[model samples]
Target: MRHRGGFRCKPGMKQGSVSLSPIPTRIVSNEEFNPPPQTQAQARVESLITSLADEASRRLGVTRRDFLRTTGGMAAALLAMNAVFGRFFDVLDIEAVEAAAFAERQGDPYFIFDVQTHYVGAHYDPADAETKRKGAVTKQALLGLRRRVREAGLNPKLGGDKGTIDDLSWENFIKEVFLDSETAVGLISTPPGPYPQEAVVPPKEMAHIRDEINRVAGSQRMLAHGLATPQLGRADLDFMEMQAGTLRVDAWKCYTGSPPKGVEHGWWMDDEKLAYPMLEKAKKLGVPRVCVHKGLPLGPVEDYNHPRDLIKAAKDFPDIAFLVYHSGFKGAASVEETFTKTGEIPWTSEFCRMKRAEPGIRNIYMELGSTFGQLVITHPLICAHLLGQIIDAFGADHVLWGTDSIWYGTPQWQIEAFRRFQIPDQLIEKHRYRPLTRELKAQIFGLNAARVFGVDVHAKRNEIPKDYVSRIRMTYLEEGPKPSHRLYGWVVG
Candidate 1:
């Protein structure tokens, strides 16, 4: 029952309300799992951010919206989080008011290459009966956040209506990912459909967007994932060849949890008889990277979505680099409690343990998409532990950056949060985890993915500033940019 509900926001549309805070204080669902209600800390953070914005706006002689649009406002949001959730973030009081001070300390220098990002084709209809039925179920799943936001007296008009499916369209995609964020390059990924053509953002459309963006940029500004469905046997393999040859996909995106029609259940990455043919085709086609959807289970059978199946497959095909999307995180609802008690982070920790056991498996990599977004806001402690554990097990070089953005509006906040996030000394000493130094964070942010994707960071960085896309962004900013401080996902209220 998965409909084509992809892109997430329409900043230009006159929604009755707008968010005053730049960062999301409550858990926001990407229509995957039901995001938990806002915790006490999140509530406090939300209130504090508003009050801080109110004071700052008055002092700066500008509207609250204008204040939040500045770098100082981003600083204020993080500063508020530190106040309520302890000192996990490194923000200065001056940063909340002085744009220069904030810019000097937290400038975007890292080569940010978001490995997982999504947006739908604009032609997709949201008003169709099929989409309405699916949208209703998604709305019900997100009710906890909706109810909580309403109860707290927050902005009721979060992301306009579900009917505004254009919020998830390609136009908004360019606005959120390119103009609004510091993302130099982004890989367009889509959810797996019953067939490749039936996906929310089909492979042909993904490649078209990629080509269009890169064409505009006049550089390698975007990459695309070709959907892989091994369960369809020869037809799937033929489709893979078409994607590799015709679409010229940079990588393959698969979902073991989502099987096509008539299939009894989901398939495994380790299945030689089924999956090996597809992998072999990819290797032959010269696209050696396979980005598999490992967590945030897409169906009723959760086990199929687990990353355990990847170990044997990765070992068997050392030439193919296996990128596990969501890093196989179980879900937002259970992460904090489970990690607190067992000192293990659900499926992610288990996957890391498996990697630890098999030191020879160097081809497997962990990606932080929706997983990092959920944990960082709700439980920074658990977020700290997860980052530590993953880095400790699979070197920082193997961890990839992915925001699952457009789903969460612009990725600037997530980028800022990660840049300022510190692994507390207690967890560092106890877990013997490497400190998240600037160099390490840089690698996780982009260097690692650059190597995997064959992106020459130095050249791209130099070229991007003069690209057509850059010119457009500069012009847009010159006219005073309006970054819809909006979360495109289902938020509380």
Candidate 2:
């Protein structure tokens, strides 16, 4: 089609020519072409739009079908874009001084609570290649070897490899990240691998694992999420109570995977056959909360960790206060629908792949442990918006901060990104992400965790020092160790 103002015409077009603007023709005399001052504003806008478009295009490669299917109308797409872009500009324009001011308002001391963290034990390191070979070949003999590999950190390539265990040592892990960063408290969970199908270890070994966890946690503001398996005999339960009641371990961590016969393993949280009894026992034990793993199945376990099962359990045991890990990722549609229909339950944005099925849903709280960095950089706006939505849905007090660290490598980057996220003052005032008041930050940072863990956060508030915010920011942004993953080549440096 031909356009007005001497624009070229295309063949076989019947419509009148559309008016077109002319391109500038002045030749640049300088080494680089500099836009006019007036155009600088336009250029900035254009640059931001272009960057946003490029990101959308990249994500579209993976989610085009979903986008097209969900956004049946162009208007809906535009609305989504407007919401996303508006937030992007807001974040980009955040002044460092404002962030510092926000940090200082809390007396520069915020109670730190890492709701999700992992610990590697001595068994994580294999003594030699013989042990490694034995672990690779024999089932029973491999239990200790696998634990060693987990402690060493699994090579993600090996389907189970995480990273080097040396990188995960409690001494190094805490010192390099938490200790120096002003971490006041942490919730530590057992690494997933130590539980074997063959149940090679006696009940004593399971108790020993709890002891090791406590030892590593030390007296420095720390709480434990005791790992449990039905495979443990009565003696094991006795030992666990001793650890929990005496040591004051906060919660019980349960895996929803099916175990092989004779091997002691945690019961699947969703398995009605096992869940009711387990819940009863947990309730009887006076355990206030249970952290259930409800996401991707690890290793040979299949169909055991579905969110639907967790939902049923939640409905059945309303008093249990179940913390569904991954927040029923596969059932996000149902979650969204549930939130839309009934304004209860909290959700997290890290599970946006599933949550996007419905926008503005609430009632599920999100933990930002494993889903930081990669998602934050790639889908900054959407992730922030989702976080906002979660805040709105659950209230900032309900949202918890976690770093599936150790497995992902220290919580530094995750913490940094959250601290750096530039949520606008207007949005904050309007409760856009459910109003992140100072009280809410305290709740998310420590109060909620303490309540869930049945600990007294107020008493330990003094344990959190001033300058912690600046310390976290500096540690994460300036002094943090770089991620070894090659995928994030640009941002690491």
Candidate 3:
């Protein structure tokens, strides 16, 4: 059992034991620690865990919470999920599960390279202290849903009174990404605020954290992303030079929906005048790999953020790699109804179909950020279809594993879930999708990323053993892992 003790808790309340089962084990819904399950499926999953936990706790001689902390607890959850849903995950007997957990307690394999990760400064702004304080107030003013959430009595005190800003700090980010999860390498990306420099995370801070982590580890474990605002024109060009020349960025992270200073609405990637100028600049600067935030659309930016523009941009610039983050998921669509009615997923299917039509757009890659996390937990079949379609269209080589971590707490849960997830044979046969082979899974997991980033994986594997970070990880595991598996994103009631 993984004990929870590293961090302090509220008075009269213990630290809610959270798990992706750091053994990276799968499980039941964490309604107590996470947002309450709103739907019937979620509620059912919760009830199953409660019932199973009751029986298992009685048999194992432990409390329900204590049981939930154990390998057997995680096994019970995964087994319950498998029983309720189809056999999408692999679950073993309690003894076997405990043994497997023991092995993972030692170490996990498949060098995990997370391409999309985020962590903001405690104060996400540096402009004004008063402005930042008021900004927090303005932000809280918009959160009227918390009241509605309270009215519904569905996870009223969602994270148990822990302030939102406090949870998303540098210390927690490192623990959640590195100590708590098996992520060997990560790329730091951010959103555009005033300009790239004064972003939620400035390029300098991003680079500093990247350097500091690697320096402490004594190996290349982190990569920083430079911001690109094509609409800003020359200003953006200047920033790109600074990021590449001065900051020495690994790649460019752009948000098509976020307009630069001069532009009013925001421009698409195919726009020759606005967007292409930045792309041209990036090519000139020699940091050509462009990671664009496509989908998980916000309010005003919906139209511009769609992955449709990627077709032209990718075809136009074969030398430049275009990564479509979030895999163009429009919203949390009803996976069950979509499959039942049309046997199609909305945005992902459309993007994949686009690839089939063009056949020349090989440079555009589909990244699984929030897309994988939401679907795998909510609807595995839809998740299966989404993965199947993307892999079939982009090929296993072009599909990347990105959890959009820190926001989702640890990437460990997503990682564990993916390792256990399987594409059903019926769906595979119906759609002619590739059964996620270990070889293919390895490619998507980190090998493909290693190839993209030009990391010598074989050499790193050798070097990492003696690195400072490896030593840190060794001491950390010996001390035992205590993960605060709290969900840090906006929760829908």
Among these predictions, the greatest TM-score belongs to 1
Cα lDDT tens digits, model 2, 1-493, are: 3222111233432211111101011111010011112123223433443444344435545332222222111112222333444543212211211334334432555666787665433243344444344324333322333344346443222234333344233343343245334456676764343342122222234334444433333224455666555445454466457646665556666656534334433355555664566666777778757776655333234355554454456556767766655443322213334455653222333333343453334334555544333334333443554567656544565567775544444454345445535556665566545544456666766677666666676656543332222233344445432222111000111
Error of 1 at 426 (Å): 1.2
Candidates ranked by TM-score? 1, 3, 2
Write the residue-wise lDDT of candidate 1 on 1-493 in tens digits: 2232222233232211236777887766665555566788888999998899999989989998889998878998998989887898989999988878988997658889999998743333443454446444433423433344335444234333332332233565777788888899999987666578988689998998898666545578899999888888898888988988898999999988877766758889998998999999989999999999888877547789999999999999999999999999988787767876888888988988899999988998899999889888888988998899888788899999999887677998899999999999988898898998999999999999999999998898888887656765776678777787756555545
- Model 3, 1-493: lDDT tens digits are 2111111122333212333322222222111112223466755666777778788778877787766655566667766667767788766655323646635532448788999988744353344465356435433532343333334544333434333433323555666788778888999876556567777678998887787666545578899998887767687789889989988999998877766545557578998887888888889998889998877554244677788998998888888999888898754545467768887776678888889998767788889887887777667778888999999998999988898777677887677677777899998888899998778888888988888889899998898776655654565567665565554433432
Clashing pairs in 3: 217-469
Model 1 — TM-score against the truth?
Answer: 0.87
TM-scores of the models, in the order given: 0.87, 0.53, 0.80
Stretch of 10 with least lDDT, candidate 2: 23-32
Stretches of candidate 1 off by over 4 Å are 1-18, 120-169
For each candidate, what is the lDDT?
Answer: 0.80, 0.43, 0.69
Each prediction's total of clashing residue pairs, residues at least 3 apart in sequence or on different chains, is: 6, 24, 1
User: Which candidate number maximizes lDDT?
Assistant: 1
Candidate 2 off by > 4 Å = 1-107, 121-169, 194-220, 230-248, 258-270, 299-302, 330-366, 372-374, 392-395, 422-438, 464-493
